[model samples]
Target: MDARVDDKVVLVTGASRGIGEAVAAEFLASGARGVVITSRKANNVEAAAERLGEPDRVLALAARSDSVDDAD
Candidate 1:
């Protein structure tokens, strides 16, 4: 898997689990610069980021699909 996704910044909504979480991990493995993972619960998001083993490379945000603000 030689994808050239290095230095890319990605924002992954609903990334606390399932498909979104998989996508985030893929991007990180591809050498993405940063990944902002958001979910409805802060703990869930933090947990997801921790799973990636690079907390410094992830920004865990508490958010829901109904919200309309870029918590960045």
Candidate 2:
């Protein structure tokens, strides 16, 4: 659980809900400078970012996890 994430940017894919959302929240709790959360739908990711409660530190991205282009 020691992430060493202080002031670091973390990316969490499939983060619209469930474990992915939890992991992203953990990164935020661990003092990550920012969390970039990705989901296939913009609305879902945006909602998740809002629920995380740190607008300045969270970015919602719509992406297909299976897509290499999206990964880029």
| Positional deviation of residue 58's Cα in model 2 after best superposition, in angstroms | 0.2
What tens-digit string does per-residue lDDT give for candidate 2 at 1-72? 697999899999999999999999999999999999999999999999999999999999999886567556
List runs of model 2 lying over 4 Å from the truth.
67-72
User: For candidate 1, lDDT tens digit of each residue in 1-72?
Assistant: 376779988898999999999989999999999999999999998999899788878898997766667884
Q: Residue 4 lDDT in model 1?
A: 77
lDDT of 1: 0.88
Weakest ten-residue segment in model 1 by summed lDDT:
63-72
Evaluated at residue 33, the lDDT of candidate 1 is 94
Q: Cα lDDT of all candidates, in order? A: 0.88, 0.94
